[model samples]
Target: MMFSATFTSLCLAAVAVALPAEKRAAPTVTDILNYALTLEHLENAFYAEGINNFTQQSFIDAGLPGFAAGRFSEIAQHEATHVQFLTGALGEDATQACDYNFPVTDAKSFAQVSYLLENVGTSAYSGAAQYLSGGTLTAAAAILAVEARHSAWVNSAVLKANPWNGAFDTPLDLNQIYTLATSIITSCPSSNPALPVKAFPALTFGTDMTAGQATTVSFNGSDASSANGMYVGFISGMNTTIVPVQNGQVTIPDGLMGVVYAVATSSDSMTSDNVTLAGPAFLSFDFKSDALLL
Candidate 1:
């Protein structure tokens, strides 16, 4: 997983620019394959760095099972195979790996981030599958299934959180997934193909969040100060619950669980990316078994 000197120099030279929002033609099948390759590169690099930085003993000392590190190694291998598969599918048009900055300080933090990444990857593949057909769709679906398994294992075995969020998983559009991905990505090579996607303005939670609790959210860009009529859409598992934003705050609804992606939208429709004001902010709500008794 060693990056070439050329890739290193490109990362040092400049930060990667966000993809522009200009009107463009529909993405061909090749575009989709390259996009998939781009994500695979990120996931592949993430596991490589994490496993290299933290040993098996580190994971055990951090309270994870002794087998956690080895399991993650297999996940890393899956990502590498995905990178190779997509690269081969795209041939000369494949996207290169980018420089990324994952904020994993220890084995505990590494597991947490891995849980998030795997979930996002699963959702990414699911969302993009609609645009594909025939063999391409079949291949992508296969990868999506594997990604979901990785997510489930990391969530339950490593983090001791619920293995599944709900009966179904949430699907995130390309722009939404790219918005979340940009948080870790630093830069890409200048030669990398410009993806035909644009990220929404960054959004973040200003207060700690819990399910069925009120919390403050913040976002940048022209719409930052205006909360009137904006809705906080929480995409958790199979549900996209929309709650009105009042003065920068919204109360999360009850029963939502696992890695919920919150977005500020102009309307309640979760599928429409055009209405997205800002965000797709990562919010995790561990399954609460005690609440079930109430």
Candidate 2:
């Protein structure tokens, strides 16, 4: 965990693996602030778009109880507050909002989109917790808590019976979070920001599961030649396995049939069984995913 220090030199040495070797100086608090700012900007835009494009009648048409404009608007305001706070904190180093293209085309999909954003937002804050200094850490923890609440509220409203999905929540690394973020993000002002973003894997699955066919699952990416094996877990993380990359693709001879909950690289091993004394981890925002493969 980062110690309380001046914003000028917030260190990221804790997660050096997440950073590139080209940088000489350690990652500063500005980096974390800028990244959080970018995410807030994106989320703000997402809600704003839905708010302006959809109406109360639209919500009713979608089979939802009431117009979610007020709820979503409040959430958007929270995100805006985060953006403003981060921008003010960064002073000259703040990142400008980038052009983004979210996937939701209709009001009915707002809750679905919120599920992805809020959960990812919560994970992003948790994963980055180690890099935050004491004061910034407290602020980040506050935001993380609200983001989780937003996620829970959305899930309860949308999914109904099972609002919270899993007993073991997954904490993703920087690359994973930013990769998902940039999937919908368009042009940016620079090649790299405080939080680095890489070109998407251009990942595509060969197995046609849309037809309910449970054939072998194989995936290919633009940079698959250099990539390691792919790891997959079900939404509950009850079942997970590894598929090796060969000849520019990762293939599972017998792919399981289910909705995938999480996917990561070989470096991050997620499936494990841990029934431990949960003491210090209560104070830690970053928690390991130790779901058993059942």
Off by over 4 Å in 1: 1-25, 221-225, 268-271, 288-294
What is the clash tally of candidate 2?
A: 0
In terms of lDDT, model 2 sits at: 0.53
Backbone clash numbers for all candidates listed: 0, 0
User: Model 2 off-target regions past 4 Å?
Assistant: 1-26, 191-194, 197-261, 264-294
Which tens-of-lDDT digit does each residue in 192-292 have in candidate 1? 87777777766666443655677676666333345677888888766788988876678878776666777889896653687998778766666645533
Q: State the TM-score for model 1.
A: 0.88
Per-residue lDDT of model 2, residues 12-63, tens digit only? 1011122221222345677767778878888988988888887777777787
Pairs that collide, model 1: none
Worst 10 residues of 1 by lDDT: 1-10
What's the lDDT for residue 189 in model 2?
67
